[model samples]
Target: MTATTTPLLGQMMDVPLLVSSLIAHAARHHGNAQIVSRRIEGDVHRYTYRECEVRSKQLAQALIALGVEPGERIGTLAWNGYRHLEAYFGVTGFGAVCHTINPRLFPEQIAWIVNHADDRYILFDITFAALVDALAPQCPQVRGWIALCDESHRPAMRTPVLCYETLLAAQNGEFDWPLLDERSASNLCYTSGTTGNPKGALYTHRSAVLHAYGASLPDAMGLSARDAMLPVVPMFHVNAWGLPHAGPLNGTKLVLPGKDLDGKSLYELMEAEGVTCSAGVPTVWLGLLAYMREAGVKFSTLKRTVIGGSACPPAMLRTYEDDYGVQVIHAWGMTEMSPLGTLAKLNWEQAQRPPEAQRALLEKQGRVIFGVDMKIVGDDGRELPWDGVAFGDLYVRGPWIIDRYFRQESGTPLVDGWFPTGDVATIDPDGFLHITDRSKDVIKSGGEWISSIELENIAVAHPAIAEAACIACAHPRWTERPLIVAVKKPGAQVTREELLAFFEGKVVKWWLPDDAVFVDELPHTATGKLQKLKLREQFRHHVLPSALEVGDKCPLEPLDSDKGAASGATANTKSAATRG
Candidate 1:
């Protein structure tokens, strides 16, 4: 009566899901769908899916002619444009790994990544031509360089470089894509490496294809052939959040903004191209919003935008949805998760809630997508409840999620078969994830835990504050307390006490930040997330007024009832997780 180990199989033809097939399907079904790009040449270029397919085939043939073997790593330092799109399909179509390098990283870091990835050839845009020349000496393993421009437009470089158009012209666009295993690696992306050296995430054809499907669901990005999609996210970042594959899979018109990602350029392109939906980080959207406010203009065709890479401030979300009539899709994920975990799309029941209630729910990171499974575990490694009160470390597992980092000889970083996301969060009964803070960023004072994200969100809600970041600082009596570092809007001024007073009723008194400081701007990672490590180091020796009063000569332990000092350890043990 036990379940059988083997079962009868159905009569169905099996085919491997590969990256090449997505572009082929688009070319065959929706041949005329346009792919628009504002090229670095200070002009816009347009092409169709059929043309893109032919050129992509040409690129594959060219790379192969240059002796690029399957499974080899090929790098790209380009923007989101037609040529970059061609590389996405071309390099992967022939079974080569497409490693997109972020040009914004330090030259040394870029060289280190290139050397670490063992990239055979780097296809770079003209904007990065000087960068390639500067780092070419450091990347000794790189075999060749190709400028992503025609023979006439190629820049003079210290190293020998090939012209992209000349290479394509030699090919007849008749190469056939090889039918490879679906598990073959198609893409490579490295973490920002803020703490140390960068680690890579190798994505397979099966994972990429499945992620495209999962990301295009109605509750996800809700992509379709009718929508004009503009991904403000770079091609180097998590495959632009999987838009390159998903866009062609659905035959959606892609509007690439190239190197001109400033507010004016992006707004003009979106309006000119009649963009319907977009996706990017919060910082990009903030610039666009600022431009719109200054110009007194609104989106004519833009509808919704997916904001990820970091938490979207409540104030920014409200402005996008209320003032501009655009739906803000708040999303959260890590590069290791194929970067798509949870997206805030309300269901019918949740939508029926009052405006205030619904807005509060939207602030959470939303429910997990179909491909992902999530849970919160306390310091003891026990799963926490979904009562929305208890917070713990977040863990996730899925087919698309990485089991091990590329080239990593160390043992797997998973815990009991789950990948720890290093985030402290709480989940509601309906399965919404409310991230409290990163495990390393949370502040512990008087035996109580404080969420820096919550504090920053409240700080940014003040009109005078343009951006804010809360970091844990040393305290004599409390061990560590929250301190706010903020940037004021242009021509806007507010005193430290006024900023501190703004958070009075938003959060509990115990959770309020000890002090607020103003700065010209804040440090950010290449991917647009706050660099708290640098902030913590800068303010490590900053003395608080309260600490000065107490005198740091000798530390004194507070009574049990003084400020819940005795319960801090127990509270952390039960609800918070300590990340290794």
Candidate 2:
């Protein structure tokens, strides 16, 4: 029988899910688990979960003694180290938000972000001492600056700053985590600001906790106590894609690589620490692979790596699995969704398919886990079917997703309750997401869209090509055409015609780049993403030799190796094409 009265709630204790609980659990259950870090001071620091808990509590007491109030923002300009990890929990345990600032950003942007967040106290590593001094004048609202180092190593700066160790030593590890509303803001991470000024994504305690749980599942990161994980991604970037939280939640040993993300450094650390799983962007993996190839080395314990931030090249995937016996987990996400929406893990049916078929599915971003719901929409705002062909704008909605920017007060960026991801993509029937291109980076040639990512992937597949970027060059006839900007391997040589001919059968004829140009290197964002925006600007006035007049019918055909060869087209030398 249907009752007219309100439904009675279950008689379970309503426990608030908080970030502090994750670390507390780790300390209680896995107190001996190690947290290793290569410090910026050219040394290594090791601590256990039990010691980490004690120090984190001491740090909270120090923050309280310094008059930091609940809901206030505490900024950290440090790399991934024990001190930074302490701040991650310490600042949040007492309800203050931990604002991680990307040190790789321009100084002006760092100052602007600090001012925008109105940080109370900035705790920074010694490496950024000069940067902190330079930013002090621009950030008048900041209460004080604390160096994340011992007193002996503190640098001489124009502005006075406190020592993190000195402060923590004075506090006893008797402080208790305050009971905070689960919805209270826990961390703040600003976007990379590739377009305009960076907007902050203030993550709440509840969202962070939920994201940690979701990301640690078997189908996601597959994290557990048995693993020693290294997050090559910086802690400043979306809390290192929520690894800092998930690591503690599952009692996974964490190895923090500080300031030396070079191939040799990472290789040694992983081997010495017995790291089984790692995560980072494609550019970082490229460096590691190049080093491995040069040194003829192999991982002893590393079993997998999660590649995100940008698309992982299919060639790179094959190299990892075939050459090195390491599985590459392709992931996709943004800062707004706590940076982990989908992780590439094959399902039972997909795993049972042929290896080639499985590889094809693995090439695409995996299906959503339990928390996230995604859909693709056409230009008319109509939902598109997941047929793997109808590409459209991608949208997502989930509990951990952002409802609005940190301080944005006006209209919402959400379209009909879903956050537009600013990505052009298609979803297969089995729910794999194939991101064609970023909305702004997609090439519009003759009213047709060309996937720059696909073109770049094929270009990088060439053995001689070290990296590649595909950008739109203005074409008088078709409005725009594709151009390949490539970087060749050191001492390797290939002609422009030879490179252009490599794409003959891989894609449609028209999708072939109109021209190829060799450069020393392509520009990258602070987070190791291809800076196509800068490339487009640099080549905006570049003239394509194959461009036709307004009324001319452009030939859409594969390159004829002999006919398409430009004079002195050797890739050993940089392109002599005229710049604007």
Candidate 3:
């Protein structure tokens, strides 16, 4: 028997075709929709969808005039601003892959990424001018640099730089968008690479457009024209969780937070723009929450917040939902998954339940979105039950999911068409996923694994703590133990005993932090996940007492100035005795 060809379910959409055509569609359909940008200069920039389209077309023409080749990469080191958004569509709309380089990464990492992506032209925001200058010497592949600034904020650099407006001025407003293959690469983002060197995930035009569509669904992000969206997540990260495209497609009001992500600035922008929806990692929300409590500021107009790039603590969910009236939507994904695999939007059945019940359900990352499939596998490579109790490595596959890493690296970890997301998770009977920890982050003590994320979340719930990270520390008896590194809230003092008490009854006694160390700040990855590796390195030499070594007195004590002085003299005396 002959195999029959399958019929396509949706319309074909290439990068230029989808982004440019959507611009035209939004201009024709939702021309009155607004785009608000808060600049670093403390000025608010405003434009309508129609005006944005006009500018985007002008930018596309300008990019063409700058000699941007059809498939060449155009990099942008920008914040979440109108100019960055313009570059997003303008570059991809003209068939060039928009490589958004994360400025937060180390200068060397940034240079490596630019060189790896082979970006021909770099469009940088004013705030990253110094960063660009630092990385310019290392990135030989970057042939041209354009500063995304107007006349007032022209970047000052020793190298000959092209002004964004000047380039636009040189070209006509009209340019033809090439009709390219749907599977052609469009956008590129690198993983935070907590485990290894950052790897690029090249997204195809087809994948990006599909991701935008999936992300806009009511069951996904539930975005619409009626909503005003402020993407607190940087544009350099996972296409800002695909909000830039989904916002325009849904005709939602776009609010760009620019370079100011501090609590006061973000709160003011959200309030002024009447932002109904926003998206960011938990760290950003933590700052916003602290600001609200300290300043008595409230988000009266905000309704929903998409929190991801790290686990959203239950306290954050409750504070936002019950106290502030903003629904905290937990989302989960990696750079390889088009950065959006699941969203925590409650279904109609769950939404009708009590708020407490709904919040409990929302705490777990919600069901897989349409076109996405998820499963869990145990150590023996057997599929685990979705009973919520069985924990295993989570694997996912979807239309928009990446099949392989860019540049064809060996050991790409794609198995049977599914990408093994390094995250260890449990899927409940209701199909919600709860991430326990990353495969490498889970601490195995005495042969039993412990979830570092669970410990960290519980520790941070302590009122005096601002943030927390738990890492596996070397143990003489147990073979491995947990060390909690925490940053205390400003003006708040917390002792190790106080924090350990907070974990009482919340987790297993064995899982309690063996030692709690206070730091000014917890190290975070570019995507905002806790950098436990750094924490481990910081406290690796901490000596713990064994059963025989333990006496009545505790081995650990606060380091006092007097003790240091005594020890300093002892060291000198010992040196003199050795010389004699």
List the candidates' TM-scores in order: 0.95, 0.95, 0.91
Candidate 3 lDDT over 1-580, as tens digits, reads: 8776996688765244355666667778999999999875668999988887778878888877778878889999888888888887788887888899888888988888888889999998877788878888888778888988777778788656788988877766766666777778889998887665798898988788788889999878889999999999999999999998888888889999998899999998888889999999999999999999999978889999899999998877888988999988899988998889888877778889997888777888888998799999999989999998899999999878888787876666688878999899999888999999988778888888888888888887788878878877666567667777778889987677778778888887888777676767777887787886655544544544332253423323212312332242322212211110
Which regions in candidate 3 have their CA more than 4 angstroms from the true location?
1-17, 351-356, 409-411, 545-580
* Model 3 TM-score, all chains together: 0.91
Clashing pairs for model 2 are: none
Better of 1 and 3 by TM-score: 1
lDDT of each: 0.91, 0.91, 0.81
Per-residue lDDT over 1-580 for candidate 2, one digit per residue giving the tens place of the 0 to 100 score: 7767887789999888899998899999999999999987898999999899999999999999999999999999988899999999999999999999999999999999999999999999999989998999999999999998888898999989999999999998997787889999999999999887999999999999999999999999999999999999999999999999999999999999999999999999999999999999999999999999999999999999999999999999999999999999999999999989988889898999999999999999888988899999998999999999999999999989998998896868899999999999999999999999999888888999999999999999999999999988777777778999899999989888889999999999999998888887888989999998767655655667777545445433322221232223332222433121
* Pairs with backbone N, CA or C atoms under 3 Å apart (clashes), candidate 3: none
| lDDT-superior candidate, 1 or 3 | 1
2 against 3, candidate with superior TM-score: 2
TM-score of candidate 2 against the unseen true structure? 0.95
Residue pairs with clashing backbones, model 1: 447-568
Q: What are the per-model numbers of colliding residue pairs?
A: 1, 0, 0
